[model samples]
Target: MIRHQRQNYDWGINAEGSSLEGGAAQVAMNGDTVFIHYICRDEDGNMVDDSAESEDHPVSFEVGAGEITGNPLFQAFDEAIRGLPLGSTTVLEARGGDWNRELFFEVPRDHAEIQRLEGRYKNQGGLQDGLIVELSNGGSAMVVAVTDDVVKIDANNMLAGKRRIFEVTLLNIEPAQR
Candidate 1:
């Protein structure tokens, strides 16, 4: 398990003579791609997700690039890690109710579209056209119903609609690939 520790540093002027405030010591800047490992838990203290289970689990995303914008938990994570230096570990809290309702509402509709496409596939077996799949962003979804021109899919994440706490560590930071 990764342990969390707090460190203090002097905020000195940068090479451009700009004053560094807050915890900006060797921090990630806009457009910087950061690699992080995180463990997330709900308010009840149940582990929802974690990247520290394996060395290969660290995830990378560009700061301020909207990669994690859709999820409120991730948005809080983005905010907490912004001014933190590399190799720093911090705990962040997020209220799931803070997520944009409209955005969450759209996910089901989008999943329905995916379900429709799955139903249209010719390789469906003798059973009804129902399949569960994992999304690229680590969510699981399943086709629950299908009709002539419509399909219903249920996609949900464990942390959705729950207050969450995240223990995150910034492992590395580099320039954005593009």
Candidate 2:
């Protein structure tokens, strides 16, 4: 594997730039749900995710509510799409690291959060291991460690501490209703 050079950027919402592709009068707006194809790679140029490879490609989400992605980096990415016409694309080079070091939390095995998580994930696979949970703060975290008395959850991105390269193309936009 070839290691790529790392680039410096602000912690959250560090937008490198964006380029509009074809000529389209329609521009992504605040309430519109935008569809986009994206590829994520690490500084080493390793592919983290590609929307095209999965059935979830051309991901769709409302521009305003995109903050559901739950990170300053992603929030900025969603914000960048607003006003971009169809066929436009954007680039974000985010530095990988625990945006919040406090992401590690240990909760009692019988805590409400733990119970709720167990109930929510029971059908999927239960909270045994490697389960992703939605945080009250809106960020998502992976179950890193589990024990009889306590469960340790880490909200850090899997690629934390590594520079990430995101190339996103705006495929389509659904206008707001009402």
Candidate 3:
């Protein structure tokens, strides 16, 4: 009975080690796949976004080096949650730099799909009224307005006007299991 109990204790400790969340994460950066459920918020602690709390599809990334560059809203992930292990929940608040900047970006044709989903309506005719886009997490946005000549997708994120925060959990790490 004593031996069995010791074995169980070791197993529990090992399980904890497998869930550490600091260091260079072994994610799929080159054609690797990672499943994550996450949320976004402004610095003010207001709920700006939440995947677990949303109806939209969970954020899945290919885990590349620069795939997330367009969205400057990654300060939360870059700082505290970058090296987290799989299945770990990482809660991070957006830094001040992520806020206070209106990220004027040009929406490429490839990004048009998300643009349409975000209600990025083209300013056809003399429509001056802005459009509101709702994220899956019940966060509605007015930054992703579209124009006639180009899709003016605001990559600064909907919560750019305020600070940002995030709660991310690694649901799956495909490459590491293999």
Candidate 4:
């Protein structure tokens, strides 16, 4: 069964530490696919990138499976949503060196899809045409060539060297099986 909540609250802790919010615990475990919606802004409060503006707004990926690696933005997100509660919205303040920003995320308790990537396959002789392959670790690569002994693959994620802020909302959580 799936559940959802549409509420917004102040997740910040003031200097005096007066208000303390409490709710159910929702931790994202390994192998679980999480769906989220997000927006990003720079230190100067300028809108940098927003997932809500994309055609497939709210992207989904498996957690702790290295599905969305090579990107600093997603790397920060993986760290932020580790133990986030479902059906709640919170702001995350990330600071490193002179870079500081806030990420807002809303995680819904429902909505998820489990996808499994197949293992490597060896051709009898060799592959002549190029083929895109999805790795078992949830990563992807393009097969440039295949020979009797070796297979050449290009595993590069274009967002590897980019820097950007992100506002993410968790829309669903599929817990890993025991």
Candidates' TM-scores? 0.49, 0.58, 0.45, 0.44
Candidate 4 structure, TM-score to reference: 0.44
Model 2, range 1-178, lDDT digits (tens) per residue?
2212222345543554444444546888988989999888887889898999988887888887756766676676677677766776667777666556687788898999889888888888789778888976688898978999999897888667667878878899889995
For candidate 2, what is the lDDT? 0.76
Please state the error at residue 28 of candidate 4 in Å. 1.4
Tens digits of lDDT, candidate 1, 103-142:
2322333465455445454375511335665555566555
- How does candidate 1 score on lDDT? 0.58
* Candidate 1 accuracy as TM-score: 0.49
Model with the higher lDDT, candidate 1 or 3 = 1
What is the clash count for each candidate, in the order shown? Answer: 0, 2, 4, 5
Model 4's lDDT to the true fold? Answer: 0.49
After superposition, candidate 4 runs with Cα above 4 Å error: 1-23, 89-164
Give the Cα lDDT of each candidate: 0.58, 0.76, 0.47, 0.49
Cα lDDT tens digits, model 4, 1-178, are: 3333222213211111011146455656677778777766565678877777888867777786544576544555665555555543334333332211121112221212111211233342222335655555666655555445445555554222333345566778988787
Cα shift from native, residue 95, model 1 (Å): 2.5
**Cα lDDT for residue 121, model 4?**
36
Best-matching candidate per TM-score? 2
- Could you tell me which 10 consecutive residues in candidate 4 have the lowest summed lDDT? 11-20
